[model samples]
Target: VAARSPEPVTPSLSFPQRREKIERRQQEVENELKMWDPHNDPNAQGDAFKTLFVARVNYDTTESKLRREFEVYGPIKRIYMVYSKRSGKPRGYAFIEYEHERDMHSAYKHADGKKIDGRRVLVDVERGRTVKGWRPRRLGGGLGGTRRGGADVNIRHSGRDDTSRYDER
Candidate 1:
């Protein structure tokens, strides 16, 4: 006599349950896209226009190299590669200037989350003031031209001696 194997029974998942699972997966993807997508970002282009200061760059990277690499995505106005002040070595970061807001939109869209020299590059607008050749004015003659908090005293120099005339007067 041939013995029939018992049929395996499985509980069926509900439609809403399956839909919820799909929705959760979709939400995760949406979140990831939102985090990295520069095009959809409202802050990408504003009154300031999109600009980015890149950091953690390779020591050998040059401005022209970075510009050429990034120009494939969009038109670059300027690229300033940061160098160490003391050591004069590349700081592994650069500032990228875009001509148009749309250019930035495209550059950032493709630049973010992208690896350069085995490291990821960050893109953001430049909001800081770039001051160059800053020189502070010399404040000579302390506080309104008075010496040691005393009233303005005039010193008169005579040919022979001013001290003798002062004592006699």
Candidate 2:
């Protein structure tokens, strides 16, 4: 009887194939890291803060006053003071847009917690668009309910009463 020869075993992956797979995995990890990087994040971009939200603004604060205060940091593109439609007065908040992000950042860093018109104001980067259909909430529950300052009366007499309270005197 002739001795049987063993067959050679094949490797699951060639050296080149393993190297390519490793490179691909490394690239995927790099891409994921880049996505999480603050510098690469869209919201962290240099122009992300070109617009700023200034809160606690004096109701009488004017756009010109805001421009003057912020202009020291950079050129002002626009200034918008939120106003109440009923009273037609400033709503205690405003948005300021700067010509450059550098100025906006400067203003945000320096003006935050600073006094404007004798009131401390908050400066922050404007985030996203304002929500639509949002309404100001009433101090207490909504109007017209007994819980909200509405009067509650209990009638002492029924309609079928024979007392004739409405009879002519």
Candidate 3:
């Protein structure tokens, strides 16, 4: 058999460029780590708390008061009443951090449907903010035109009567 020449290997990138790429990768990993629940890991054994978001809260409710109310159900580590960055006032919602999974469950159980100043609050895990990728197209004619004046917009989801609202039987 004839001997074949070896293929040439590509040169390694420069140290500075390689290090920069590594740093960027590390930062991405750190951001992803922030999204994970520590309690979800079976190997994780610590006093760290799980965070929950409560929406539809009274705008006047303070963080301390929110925490105190949830403390009756479980050990609350902290409460952050979300506020509008522009207005510098409460945004009618809050995020709660509890010290244990049991506390998180208890808070969700008892806190939901509980009225706070006549407004029932809804609580759940604090999911990452979803980016609005698209806006829905407006129906009917432009601002000045009436809805009926525009082209017909038929919704055939159920295949029912097309115009029954106006049936004068």
Candidate 4:
């Protein structure tokens, strides 16, 4: 048996190199998103059932890190880290696709609130695109939001079988 060495982390690179790498990864992800029309792509249908939506991820976390963290449940197919187009930086969320729907559900059950890269991430069954009439956090809809001294109208999971909610009310 042999142990595998961890992949090179950002610390191994000089500051300038790290910045460039991050920018490049962000650009790549954003460009892929721009070209991906999964809703209409027949190839993406399986992803809807076998994907876990992970939120509140650490901004610096990488895809390999996420795979190592989540693969305990089962084999992973892919990881899609979301990024902001204008900022060209991580958006603190990602979609983890598993090779099997059962694996996806297992991750949804066990990975929520699990610490990753020093941050506790939220995990849920992917819904925004699969569920009808569901909206993301940007369009005034999301699973959860913190109170900012306004009307207590915060909603998350919205009675839709979410268990990892960090509700502060």
Ranking by TM-score: 4, 2, 3, 1
TM-score: model 4 vs. ground truth: 0.60
How far residue 45's Cα lies from its native spot in candidate 4, in Å, is 7.5
lDDT of 3 at 118: 76
Stretches > 4 Å off in candidate 3? 1-49, 129-169
The per-residue C-alpha lDDT of model 3 at residue 149 equals 30
User: What RMSD, rounded to one decimal, does every model reach?
Assistant: 28.9, 27.0, 20.6, 14.0
Local distance difference test, candidate 3: 0.59
For TM-score, the strongest prediction is 4
Clashing pairs in 4: 143-156
Per-model lDDT: 0.56, 0.63, 0.59, 0.74
Candidate 3 lDDT tens digits, 87-154: 99888987777888667766765687678777888775443321112111221111122122323543
Q: Model 2: runs farther than 4 Å from truth?
A: 1-48, 129-169
TM-score of each: 0.44, 0.48, 0.47, 0.60
Cα lDDT tens digits, model 4, 24-141, are 8778766665665447764344567788889899999999999999999999988888889899899999988899888887787688889999999988777655666555454444
After superposing candidate 4, which stretches have Cα over 4 Å from the reference? Answer: 1-38, 41-46, 144-159, 162-169
List the lowest-lDDT window of 10 residues for candidate 3. 134-143
Clashing pairs in 1: 57-92
lDDT of 2 at 140: 16
* TM-score for predicted model 3 compared with the true structure: 0.47
